[model samples]
Target: MRVTWRDHSPHSEAFDDIYFNPLHGKEESLYVFWQGNLLNEKLAGNVQTVFTIAETGFGTGLNFLCTAQSFIGQSKEAQCLHFISVEKYPLALTDLAKSHTCWPEFKSLSDQLIQQYPPSTPGVYTLAFLEGRIKLTLIIGDAASGFSQLSAMVDAWYLDGFAPSKNPEMWSDALFQQMARLSHKGTTFATFTAAGAVRRGLQAVGFEVEKRKGFGQKRERLVGRYLQDNIPEPTVTPWFDLPSQARPEQVVISGAGLAGCTTAWALAQRGIKVTVLDAADKPAQGGSGNPQGALYTKLSVKPTLQSELHLCASHFSLNLLRQLDPEQTFWSECEVVQIATDDAERTRQQALINEAAYPQEIVEDGSKDTLSKLTQQTVTHDGLIMKLAGWVSPADFCRALLNHPCIDYVPDSQLTELTYQDGMWIVQTAAQKTYHTSTVILCQAEATSQFVQTQHLPLKPIRGQVSIIPASVTNQKLNQVICGDGYISPPFRDHYCFGATFELKSTSLEITDSGHDTNLHNLAKVLPDLAADFEKSKHLLTGRVSFRCSTPDYLPIVGPAPDPETTLERFAPLRKDRKWKFSNVSASHLPGLYVNCGHGSKGLVTTPLCGEYLAALICAEPLPMRKPIHDALNPSRFLIKNLIRKQI
Candidate 1:
């Protein structure tokens, strides 16, 4: 986005309009958006549990800052402000900082926002503030398409964008329809524009718009409420439909690995009591127990649901790691380099760099020289350099996450049975110890499907082993994590961890000599010069072997678990007619059963976001993901897909 400074105020070059009324911008923001939405009354005391605010434009994020400051002032315990905004042409960091200079009152909050501001990438970024009490989902794309992908129940709207005449796309019928889709009765909206077409469009979509005294010298502005929500929700894909549930008194997580610990952290921060159960003696004893894991994203050449999820997860995970590990002892943003060893891989990397249009702050194409410089070792192939990504001690991260005051970590307890009765879930471990809770989440990797409710999920187990090689004085001190078919981290506790063979056939938990040989081979391939000493002394390598949980589509299975017999019977009509729309049929789910496993190898980067998503869904807050991506990760997707294909 290009912005020009005029009289010390930021002016949008694309829309040819000023960002705000420059005279009293702060007061105008409070007057037109804050007080106009009646937030003073709605957010005072304990009127509601959560109040969501969505905006058409996020110019300088001034409105968000003002709202965040106010929300924290009035919001009490268990009350949250979920702020979402869409921006087609997002300003750069320097530009945003320059625009934010006009408000000295919002310096503290504005600085925090600036510090956490994401790279200029086109995707959804869910950021947390005030200990997750104030959430922000910034959609960096076109307003209408972005909101169309979002599934939220908004309580207020900040219609702040360029004028209707200059930016017609922001004031279209589609946007109005989306507003109606996300709103219900009593939902409020405040806009700086009072154009006749704008008022008519909103009224046509069930909003009651009225003119109010404008800010400053302006004559009038539009303030309204969503009185009648006539907009119809999707009749298709009802199996992926998500309805909110009440806040539970207690939640039980099946595993104490990355997924469970992160999930517990998310819920505990939201004031929910969580109990994490694990089979091992301590947390992160499974695949997440790797000595060091790469924190990076494998972006596709073009954007797909999988790629978008990765982009979103990478951004979220990067921020979370920093927040959880501030000292850089167990986590460090030392950057990561994924080398393309062969000609075909080089071509693919080149195409990704040329076609993907990703922000340089997130990823950049590495020529052979760039790769060598980043790794501080000699390399001959092209690669991708993840700037903000790094290496993390997964075990340490998980252990620290489960140390929350609201979390109870019970080791040596393997969840064996789950049954929901009388609005409560009875959870039993291997020793017949039973605990009752209102909700149960399965995060136990491959063991997640051991329960009857989740047995239908097509979870696959892939064996992975990471070899630990002692770093010698003669070996080069690798600064960044390097990846090819296998990955090697920088030194951790005087040992370099590498390899990790992804075997689909082997389910062996015991480490084998072949695993070490495979690690040596991959190490030789990815970094021949660095592996010279290790290859000669390969016998000194020892590793840890564990099975990783994956799905047929490779996406994590999240969201509520479908009732086995009921879903089979209800969706059986699809077998006769693939396009069958059971308009009268509603999907059935196991009351409070949810799944959060199947992270596979990207567990370090993906688990945190999925945890936040599930927590938001369970807590009845605005979701942390787009609707399509959420559906793609739905636990019932395989069932519905197979029912239509007549394979079930």
Candidate 2:
């Protein structure tokens, strides 16, 4: 049966499954055995967490969209539903939108997906929806290879491919073997094909295959479960012997910057009582206290893994801010303009606008005239404007997270030391006052080096200063956030904030004349009209300086930090040969300990998602990102990479 795909419109497209004989109607193609069983059973009710489902092929994403609609209709308390799908050939974003229109019921869900679909990349791409509850991890690659590399357990599997005959590669014995390798004992699977080869392949590998009444005009379909005999059990590492449950009801978080407050909010949501220990009287007195900051997605034309993560994080952060109260929290809808001064940047932007289907209405090209009108400044160049991007008060946002009912704001208390005794982490202040808790999160910015456990971790402290200028009536209330060599936010509360000078050698928190002058010089490039305002506000130009903690590769250090020596020894066999199998080995994990720092300049965009990621890791819930992003942000990535690099 030859299938016909219709590129219905510039924004829509659809393809019929030639092998699937629909007995119902055109809509019957949407029905598959796996989808029916998943929808009928209340699997999430028995589990105390956000359920996750991973798929092999996302040709049209029909299976995922259908599952999302069903999951939403079923449970209200289902904290989150994560659907991760892999596809080698992805359609254009506009084509996806067009194809999605065929399903009226899925319009709302598809609309959201089409709006935030990431740029095409070879590695994993994550998109968050429904306020971070529903997440999609789309890995654009071959199913067999992708599934083998994936690190996730699927509750239900939609084994969708072209057909046993037409797409034999998808259902080959090797592929089924890989699927069996990834399946847990009770893992369930369903497919439309009842072909003898498929059944034998599945049975040969551990699945207890069963025939079911087919959907539409088809007479039969197949569904099955991984049996104990064929399914291999995971080997428990010595480190995993540690308790996996939540330590206690209480935790002590040191530091009150964005990192600390975000961690506090995450813990509070989990019903964990939190006491924030800060040296200063208030939160955001550190690196997070910047008066104005820009929020923009970073993309690379070469399509690297880092770029993919940033794109996902940027969109997730933007959506998260939208869910919060604008007035209480410090945020603005000021658009971000990425000026095209260099050919390299211009080429990158052009590729992004052409291949990636961003929320178009939110990002567009601005002529010099349009730019001047929007920014209220003379512009000599054209640039791409991100309408959804803007600036936010990092300090105010930190305060909001600390305001939760489960949080106890402990000010003027600085952490002096950390020691584990009586199965509790005791955090002592300089005055000898100690606070005890089973779990402790270090979010003290660059001061994290003071902690014994993380002292060996490679983190650098770079000082940065931001100057404030009074908004003059003629200062032109800039309508959008502008950026060139530096950036400036629209006037807020009678003051326009700009000028951020980065000095790696400087460590003092005191503001300096040189730092102020450097900021003023940088600010003149974007808004030369403000040169006079700089002079007027130079005397009134108060500034704050803080240190930003960053890792070598720039990815945040999140998830469990296993004992370094133990991990190095456990996986030492891999150092000898690249053929070592990780199938049976479990990575070691430190008991009741994790880290969520080293966010660098993307603190606002990555921190909230990092909080969610940490919660998921603690709960052993399904991960929001695919294996690559998880591995990228893994706390031990640096250590493991260094070991691998050393062997070479």
Candidate 3:
């Protein structure tokens, strides 16, 4: 059947479901037997961790909203409640708001969900709600096709598809069989259908099927349990042994930019002493000292692994920034306009907007006139406006993060070398002073490559220079951040920061007249009215230059590093034979050595989240993101992939 969004407004006469029939006052259908009996009590009472519930059809999201409300009332002290559902034909954002008005009792829960609902993508879209207590995973696609690729275990089943005669695909034997494969032996399933094929298919997969009273004018429904019938249990992967606990006293970090300050804060929070060493006279004096940086997010039309990971990190970082002191740190809720320079780029943006199912409030179509008004300029092209995007001061945020009580600020101290001896990582300064700690984190930007241990790592230094200009009263009228070929921030600190020149071949940190002229020329293209102010800004264009350390793929290298040769030799057999097994194998990591570097251009958006992720890994806490991100940022990934390809 061709699918469309179901109208769920209480005021609208089209909203009709027997289970929630106000006229009949709540009757039981097979839908109740399947959803209420199987899912609610069975898996909830048994699971030790946060219970996650996923559904294929989220028509009005009644099933998920109801499940959340019930779980909150019944399961107290449950670590978290996760309700994930999908809808191929999602309603407009306004329609969702109207539908939610029907349930005033669930207003608080619905409001939070509505606020962070991601733009619809073709694949999985994960959302965190209730201050990270509840998670919602939505996969908008065909039920059978979507479930087959989903990698989550369900404790209970809610089989509430349309009637088998009307929507046979929803209740097909193949679908039931797939569900059987996805469910555990003790999984209880309930459905409003008592069809012979449904029962037979479930029973064929070892479930004990039974009939029950149906809800809402329906005569009968079915509920069943998967019983073990002497089949062998699946083999579980052996858990890796935990690393030996280290003496948690102190750590020495060799940088004072965003990465170094963030790591220092993470260590300080865990009751560990932190000494941040840097050659600059003050913190954020390097690449992170940009006057204003944009929180840019690159999203894809299809839910690729990279897009998924970025969505999670973006939201996490946004929320983390909200909890900081906004006065001392510069952050704005202003929108960001990602103008399409050409038709091809516009097409890509349109495709992403449709797949993303982003709220209309967050992303909207813009005309050239609207763009001109938003940027306070005369002319502009049509494009997509991202309301959730904004700008922040990288230097100020770094300062705020490093303001913790347990951190010691040791600026003007240049780190010369790091030596691991006698169970301690000794860091020596240029003045012959030595500081010994059990853990050492390297975050000194491009200077990090100077260390002997990380000399072999592929890190390149690129110089970036941003021009500072005093914004006139007219220039200050610009309300939002604009991005075309280059980016310009809204007026801040009595001046607007614009025209950042990127040079990959430049080695000298000295500010040049040519670079300054290049910046002014670039700024003129975006804001032509500011031509008169350009010369005055040029006269005041005394700016700082810093080198950004970046990797080839643009993803940062985090986590532990092992000896390269040893890692290659150990994984060699697995490369030759995919099924090869090795025993008593251990990672040849440099003990207690970790690096959080190579953030590149997206440092403002990716760095803070990276710091949190590194902290979670070091402390052995539950990660903020799923498994793929953890793997993407793994320090050993390059070595392992190269070894597998025999290129190492």
- The better candidate by TM-score, 1 or 3, is 1
Q: Give the distance in Å from residue 398's predicted Cα in candidate 2 to where it truly belongs.
A: 2.4
Q: Pick the candidate with the highest lDDT.
A: 1
TM-scores of all models?
0.97, 0.81, 0.71
lDDT of 1 at 435: 99
C-alpha lDDT of all candidate models, in order: 0.86, 0.69, 0.67
RMSD value for candidate 3: 6.6
Candidate numbers, best TM-score first, in rank order = 1, 2, 3
Off-target runs (Cα >4 Å) in candidate 1 are 229-232, 473-475
Q: What tens-digit string does per-residue lDDT give for candidate 3 at 128-208? A: 555445667666556776665554555666676445655566666666665766666676777767888888888887788
RMSD of 2: 5.1
Better of 1 and 3 by lDDT: 1
lDDT of 2 by residue, 1-648 (tens): 122443442211133343222223224434663453453464544464556667767766777777787767775654567777878667666556656666777888887788666545455555666755677877777888777666566666777767677667777787787778777777778877789998899899888988887776579888888886444346322222222555357878888887788777766766669898999988888778888677775655455767656665665566556655545247886678877656776777788777665545446877778888877777767778876467778887887778788999988999998887887777899867988777777777667766767665778888888777677635455777787666777776777777677777877988899988887777665566765567665788887787788888888887676667767776776567534556555667555666778888778877877776666556565554555676777766665665556542
Q: Once superposed on the true structure, which residue ranges of model 3 sit more than 4 Å away at CA?
A: 1-49, 70-78, 123-126, 140-216, 219-286, 298-329, 339-370, 380-384, 395-457, 473-476, 558-563, 570-596, 607-634, 644-646
